[model samples]
Target: MILEQAILNIKPEESIVFEKAFAEAQKIISSMPGFVNLDLLKCIEETDKYLLLVKWESIEDHTIGFRQSEKYNEWKQLLHHFYDPFPVVEHYETVISI
Candidate 1:
């Protein structure tokens, strides 16, 4: 599995709005090929910050398949504007797990 991680810095007081948008966006991504699951996390110290972890069958399924699809545009439209500066996204593979 491939894990895609992003630290989203949302605008002040936009958590509720972003959460709603994320719920909608989740449905879209979940329907895509190779999608395994998604998790949205919030920072206790920073209310405006969130972490998005998405699991995919492979990197290509997310980087190439999802990004190139029309649904990505819709996803961006729903949630991208909430970010002050776009978050940086990174990918990882599991090394060890208990």
Candidate 2:
């Protein structure tokens, strides 16, 4: 499995609006190929920050497959504007498990 992580820094006072938009965006991502699941976490100390953990079957599933699909355009339209300075996305593979 591939783990995609993004730390989203939303503008202050726009958290609720971003959450609603993100819900819609999540629906789009869920329908894509190789998509496993997603977890949205909010920082208690930094209310404007959020962490998105997305699981995919492979990196290509996200980079080449989903990003090239029309659904991604819609997803971008829905949630991209909410970011203050755009989040940096990174991927990881499980090295150890217990």
Candidate 3:
């Protein structure tokens, strides 16, 4: 599985609205192909920061399958505006697990 990670820095005081928008946006991503699961974690030290982790079957599943699909526009529309400078997304493969 490929793990997609992004550190989202929401606009000041917009976390609540972002969360609500994400609630709807999550449904869009969850319905896509190769989607395993996702978690949205809020930071304790920085309330405006959030960690988004999504598991996919392959990198293509997210880069091509999802990003290239029309659904991506919906996802962007719902949650993109909440970001300040925008987030950097990265993908990883597990090396070791207990």
Candidate 4:
């Protein structure tokens, strides 16, 4: 499995609205091919910050499959505006797990 991670920093006090938008956006991503699961964690120290983790079967399943799909536009429209500087997304494969 590939792990997709991103640190989302919302614009100031827009977190409440962002969360609501994300709630709608999540449905877009969850329906994509090779999607396993996802989690959105709010930061304790920085209320405007959030951690987004998604599991995919392969990198292309996200980078290519999801990003290239039409649904991505809807997803972008829903959540991308909430970001300030925009988040950097990275993918990783497991090394070892207990």
Per-model C-alpha lDDT, please?
0.96, 0.95, 0.98, 0.96
State the lDDT of candidate 4 residue by residue for 2-87, as single tens digits.
Answer: 99999999999999999999999999999999999999999999999999999999999999999999999999999998888899
lDDT agreement of model 2 with the native: 0.95
Cα lDDT of model 3 by residue, 1-98, tens digit: 99999999999999999999999999999999999999999999999999999999999999999999999999999999999889999999999999
Name the 10 consecutive residues with the lowest summed lDDT in model 2: 76-85
For model 3, give the RMSD to the true fold.
Answer: 0.4
Per-residue alpha-carbon lDDT of candidate 2 for residues 1-95, written as tens digits (9 for 90 to 100): 99999999998799999999998889999999999999999999999999999999999999988999999999999988889889999999999
Using lDDT as the measure, name the better of candidate 1 and candidate 2.
1
- TM-score of each model, paired residue for residue: 0.97, 0.97, 0.99, 0.98
For candidate 1, lDDT tens digit of each residue in 1-98?
99999999999999999999999999999999999999999999999999999999999999999999999999999999999889999999999989
In model 4, where do residues sit more than 4 Å from their true spots?
Answer: none
Per-candidate clash tally: 0, 0, 0, 0
Query: Relative to the unseen true structure, what is the C-alpha lDDT of residue 32 in candidate 3, on a scale of 0 to 100?
Result: 99
Cα RMSD, each candidate: 0.7, 0.6, 0.4, 0.5
TM-score of 4: 0.98
